[model samples]
Target: MDNKIIAILCGLLTCFHLSTAFATENGSDSFSLGAEGIMAGALPPAGLYFLGYYQNYHANKFIDGPSQFYVDANAVVPRFVWMTNHNIANGQLGWYVAQPLVDLKVKINGLNDSNQGLGDLYLGTMLGWHHQNHNWLAALETVLGTGDYKTPSQTHLVRANIGKNYDTIRPIFAYSYLNSNGIDLSTKISYSWNSKNEATNYKSGEYFAGDYSLGYRIQPKIKVAVEGYYFKQMKDDKDNGKDIDFKGQVLAIGPAIQYANKNWSLEAKFLKETNVKNRPEGHANWLKLVWAF
Candidate 1:
């Protein structure tokens, strides 16, 4: 394998689900399931909700330092989420659970690795508010993940790993605003902190992510939007207490469409990475269906 490819893999150890950062083989969200857009703060009627989502990510090439390497990496993540109601902090409280199934493949330089299996279990509780008169909604939530799946060894150059191997805390703030004019805006920001991977004794750096959407509702059941997100690492990953100078970042934007009825909602978005460092630059796509019960 080329040294540049090695650097690419090593440089992205923190890319997995965004635990202390979410962890993944490609990256978080696109691994951890964070950074949602469009009506992120909208509160539904008090009841049970179920969501099914799928994402396909393809990045065939990457740049690291002054070297660029060829890669043909693709990942398919299927996720399911369940949320229900309660009351907390004088606001409606909702608790949710998410399970992710991941199929990842990579071909970098002349080496290849693939893995298909269960990822991590994510759970969270949120307090949500909707002011109908003001057309505003807001939510505060804390997400947590269990690291009980596949983890790469410390000496791996490339491996098929589905889990980050560290417990993570992801706290989030979500807001949205809409008016009679059909204009709408939504944003969500989340920060993650991860515990050390005792098996490898590696500590990924903390990270911050922000997602936004601007849209216009053409009708009560149809909408179009522009969606984008930004991610930045706050510090360097550590190996047994040694800083590794491998912070990473990326930005993406694209268009989206959503259709909703009384009981079901469907959404699709396409994002292209506009800028990146020590990471892959390519296209990511999302398809989601949600139903209220």
Candidate 2:
């Protein structure tokens, strides 16, 4: 019968590309506060929503000592969403939360460094499965500390996403893992679990990341994206005894632009670190702004 109808249409197109890569690995960026889609356009039973953002960072290391530029002023950065849709067990469910409020400053190697504090708080969830044209997603996220002032030392994240929605364009892939513990501020110490000395009690360590995205809408509101990210940092019992080895790696690439309607939305992003290891003043650059309801 025509070769069994072309082998059942090539096995249903390879299960629809593995269910859109597992719905873009579970859709993240912390509920779209980071932008790129996967929050189901603002999930929930369809009620209560909010978002805000602001970010900035600059660096220069043509060959110097330290100093890497920094600036992050956040105001009312918040997000909360919930959505549900299950008709006879078809699929659709999501939840989200986000918070930000920080002010930072640095000059490095030349002196002048400051940190106001309050950043890092997120929670997310998603589940989708409905095929008629396309639909398949799975996601999970976490990063909570409930910041108030000095933050860092609160980490927990898990992700898996896969997406495919063609009509305009939607491509996503993600994999994430993070676990942090190490913070005891007295004076000079930021990130890397507060410069671990033994990390006295908070015992710092953990990081593993991955990201990839492609979204283009242009019309239905507007969308644009290009992203890449990778990070690794995990090795500390105080590094066995410490001869002199910290272990770090980071790579970043970016370009993002978004605009939405139905309520309000606007976003911008730019990241470039190319590649870095051990810490070359940790090259960096960032910019962000978002608002939603």
Question: TM-score: which candidate is best?
Answer: 1
Best by lDDT: 1
- Per residue, candidate 1 scores C-alpha lDDT tens digits across 95-153 of 66566666766555555566666665665656666675232233333333342344444
- What lDDT score goes with residue 63 in model 2? 20
Q: What's the TM for model 2?
A: 0.24
Name the lDDT value of residue 292 in candidate 1.
65
Worst 10 residues of 2 by lDDT: 6-15
Model 2: per-residue lDDT, tens digit, 10-116?
Answer: 00000001111111111111122223321222222333445444444334441222233222223344455555454324546556565555454433334333444
Tell me the lDDT of model 2 at 198: 24
